[model samples]
Target: MVGVPTAIAILAFEPPHGATALLALLLLAAAAAGFREPTPLWYIERGWAVLLAGGFAVSTALAPTRPILDRSLLTVAIAGATVAAMGAVRPELLVGLDWQVADQFERTLARYDFGWLGGPPAEAAVRQFAALWQALYPAMLVLASVSALAVTVYLLGRVRGEESALPPLGRFRFSEHLVWVLAAGLVLVALPVGAWADRAGGNIVTVMGGLYVLRGTAVLVWLGASVISSGWIIAAWTLAALVLYPVTMGATLVVGVSDTWLDLRSRLGVAGNKE
Candidate 1:
């Protein structure tokens, strides 16, 4: 009756983050339909409904002539802020998250290994790689939250009599202030705090690094869009990405971080392309 999209969205996350946070948000929003007296909760419910409605109605209805991002900036921005707040308030939430991912990765790698062909490349190597990936789990959570928030906000805007829609990928960008957060995370993990070092720093660095990758992806899309309009090109790129994603992510990370100082959008004329 109400909406099932929230369930679909929550499934994208691990049980820990999904069960606790996502359900809490859903229930809170539901409460607004009858239980809550506050007006803002109504906004949350209405927004959520529109979000679940696939955004088709409002996407075409509101500001159709304007840039898709004209209204979506607020939705995405709120998502970013929500992610930052969650990381700041529950830094330790990532502690269990990392271990869960590590354990899962280790199992998958071992299952796929052919003992005759390199014999899983030593348990130490496997564990090390798992640890490295685990360090990035917190950041992954933040990225997912941003996606959820963008959809939620867009839906909210659509139903609340405000015009909003999700924007094109190329419009995404991270704020400069986050550089300091990443720097602080790196500095903390760099210190001699034994077990605590990675935990403290990983939470910040991974989240920020994920943002950099997103920013770089936007840059890539912007650059590509300049000459390539064919959707098939995207399909081909994604097909190539399955095997080359690690390499692609590495390049994206480098380019994204570099943009902090290089002012890439302006240099590439992507800024002008948008406005």
Candidate 2:
């Protein structure tokens, strides 16, 4: 299910060598995921070596002029593209989700006495909001995949009676070069790209922007952690998120983008180097 769409999406971008790249990426990702949290379980203990070896084999086959790849970024792009491809192939998937959201919205509204707020205008507002939500389904799915990965990592640690090796959210950062991907996305959006390419660019911007928000928040958390207790940090963040969402997000996004250039954590002499 995942591989087919992912391969198709990659081929759309790099037809001649996409399949080989996809195979290499899958091997590398599988190896990294397994090796990061190796278990005494039979399959994991036995299979991770094979996965790593396979990844190396593929890379070697393309050696001398091996295509440069950022394993993490490519993995994420492939996952997001796969999700968007799935929606494209069977749009009813998103339609079903949209219907569920609309149904729940109506049910909630029915339970509330909107009084003057409930009218044709309110109905129109709901319709508009629903349309916006449906359009954002691709970005939502990309974020959902990240959330699911986090949950799975947490749960794996719990099931194994071990602390997760995952770094604290406060220390999160990704490659600074990823800003180029977001920039490329913006250019695509601004230009008269084909409809499909434009939509893909929109998805890229939305997903990357969401990630940078988290990275920016992490920078803030790192700053706060040095001076305040975790409880206070959490409380403050929760309050700000609830009461000043747009302001907080905008500030964080700016901070995140700045961090890429400024390398804020290192400047503060508190680079969390656990990874």
Candidate 3:
């Protein structure tokens, strides 16, 4: 709904080359969703959300062309309501996992002028905006990383619980089969690099590592919940990580060491030799 108009507007404004990348990213996201171990109802909910978000975003982007406004409004309504519903279902996840880290990033950005490295801003307002964004980028990354780490820890804890009541890993098990597919995808994606920075570059490894960690954590949480009544605590930790990762990562960069070491150590101590 929203995305169709948005995509059309974007195509109208941007060159065809941009569409390719956008489409690829969307496809990747779709593939990732396919791998999730969700019930039919869950899938329907997720699908609708994705569609609404995509549609709204695309339509908004292309709004200048004077396309149908009612449909766009409907898309926005659906997407917004869905997000609200999600929050209602998992308020902790919404607040703990998302908002805390977002605040940290915003604060960090305020500390530094946005890092605009490119050409001169066309206007004073634009320049200020760019500067603001530049300053905020590092903080945002740190926040995102912290959030991710927290989620990972929470999931890991759940996986280790003995009496956990968490759901099964199901399609999101991150099994050998999935690993192989991911590996193959990586190799295929990386094959185009030249000698200066070959296919097996640090960037490739970094991306793959991140993916592995994310998927592994999700699976661990699922498994942990299966064996313990208190497995949901893992999800809480994940939320914490997501919120704190950005600030923590930024601190690590500034301090020249991993900021999460103490936290990780403490968590390990608590978990003990349960593995």
How much does candidate 1 score in TM-score?
A: 0.54
Residue 74's C-alpha lDDT in candidate 3? 39
The Cα error of candidate 1 at residue 238, in Å, is: 3.3
For model 2, how does the per-residue alpha-carbon lDDT over 142-184 read when each residue is reduced to its tens digit? 5654554344334333433567535677778877788998998
lDDT score at residue 132, model 3, on the 0-100 scale: 52
Question: lDDT per residue, candidate 3, 38-151, as tens digits?
Answer: 644345444544555454445545552332222333345555566568879988754553444446545654574434533344345554665554434423332333333233
Segments of candidate 1 deviating more than 4 angstroms: 1-138, 160-164, 272-275
TM-scores of the candidates in the order shown: 0.54, 0.61, 0.25
Q: Candidate 1, clashing residue pairs? A: 47-156
Off by over 4 Å in 2: 1-116, 229-237
Backbone clashes, each candidate: 1, 0, 35
Q: What pairs collide in candidate 2?
A: none
Residue 67's lDDT within candidate 2 is: 21
Q: Pick the candidate with the highest TM-score.
A: 2
